[model samples]
Target: MDLHARLKTYLQNNPEAVGKVVDYNAGTDRLFPLDLTAANTELTTAIIADTQAFSNWVSDKLRANNCRYGIGGYMEHRTIYAVSSHFDTEDEPRRLHLGIDIWSDAGTPVYAPLAGKVHSFQDNNNQGDYGPAIILQHDLNGLALYSLYGHLSRQSLDGLSVGMSVHKNQQIATLGNNQENGQWPPHLHFQLMFDMEGNYGDYPGVCKYSEKEKYRKNIPDPGLLLGF
Candidate 1:
């Protein structure tokens, strides 16, 4: 079977093995679907460029919907990356987001959905970068899998080390503020990868539109494990 097929089958077979990536309660909290694409006319360029304004916009959306979390952006073609040159390239700009972003308040806790060992971690502190990020290595039977948590608080990396074992539902990190989380609104960039391609600490969360098919093979929708 292919990677996507295997992942979907594994998740479907072992629902109890996966845990929440955030402090979400199905009974009390609602998840508001957020749109950061060009279709979202309300997100003006000015608000996209201004960190505080963008944060306030996210908060307003969640509050208006009476939800605790704003979630979306898996394989989403986002225009918000125009706010930073970090995503620009001579060939093409990276506009396709390869992860699911959980928009929430800074300092909100992030948890591991499965037991794994820290594969790599570092603070990618560039503008529009991932900020404090982590990649965990997991095994589904014999299949090698990886999970990345990005836009995390610097404190999240405080005692972490390579190959450190983490348990399911363990509090691994917290969401960071705009001042630290790549100058954007606070959110957790959760992604799953079949391979790291020798990358350590950080990987491209956004890919060039032209290379979407190439990345699609390596990166799959995180919702497979998130159970959204």
Candidate 2:
């Protein structure tokens, strides 16, 4: 089987952690899918101007929707990337996002969806970085898969070691605010990776528009795991 099939098979085979992620239960939580692309000009214009505005916009959306979280942007070509030089390069410019972003208030607790040992973590402090992030390595039927939790509060990494074990639904971290979480609205950037490509502490959560096919295979739709 190809990597996508293998991942889907493994995840389906072990279906315990589907709703265990942050406030994304299909039945209970009022979750709304957010659009952050250029086509969402009203929202983009309101948020892209500044981080505070971004935070306010997120809060307003959540409140108006009566939702605990606004989640979307998997492989989404977002205009919000312009706020940071981290995505800007002389080359293709990383606009294609590769993960599902769960927009919520700062300090919202993030739970580990599956049991695994911490593979790696670091404070990727930059304009558009992960901030304090954690990655876990899970072996499901001998399939080595990884889950990355990004834009976490600094305290999340406290006493956290590379080899520490995290159980399913474990409270691993909380959402970081704008100042520390790469200057965007407070949210959790959750991603799945079949392979890390020899990178540590961080992986490409966003890629260039031209490399969609290559990444599409490597990064499956997170909705498969989030269960909503």
Best by lDDT: 1
Relative to the unseen true structure, what is the C-alpha lDDT of residue 177 in candidate 1, on a scale of 0 to 100?
Answer: 96
Model 2 clashing-pair count: 0
lDDT of each: 0.93, 0.85
Query: What are the per-residue Cα lDDT tens digits for candidate 2 across 1-228?
Result: 987898888778768654377756567789878888878877865457688987888899889999989889888998778777888989778999999999998999998888889999999998888988999888777778889999999888899898899898889999998888877789999999888899899999999999999988878787787776
Q: Candidate 2 regions off by >4 Å? A: 17-19, 44-46
Clashing pairs in 2: none
Mark the regions of model 1 whose C-alpha exceeds 4 Å error after superposition. none
Q: Tens digit of lDDT per residue, candidate 1, span 1-228?
A: 998999889888988888989887788889999988999999999999888999999999999999999999988999999989999999899999999999999999999999999999999999999999999999988889999999999999999999999999999999999999888799999999999999999999999999999999999988877765
Q: How high is the lDDT of residue 198 in model 1? A: 90
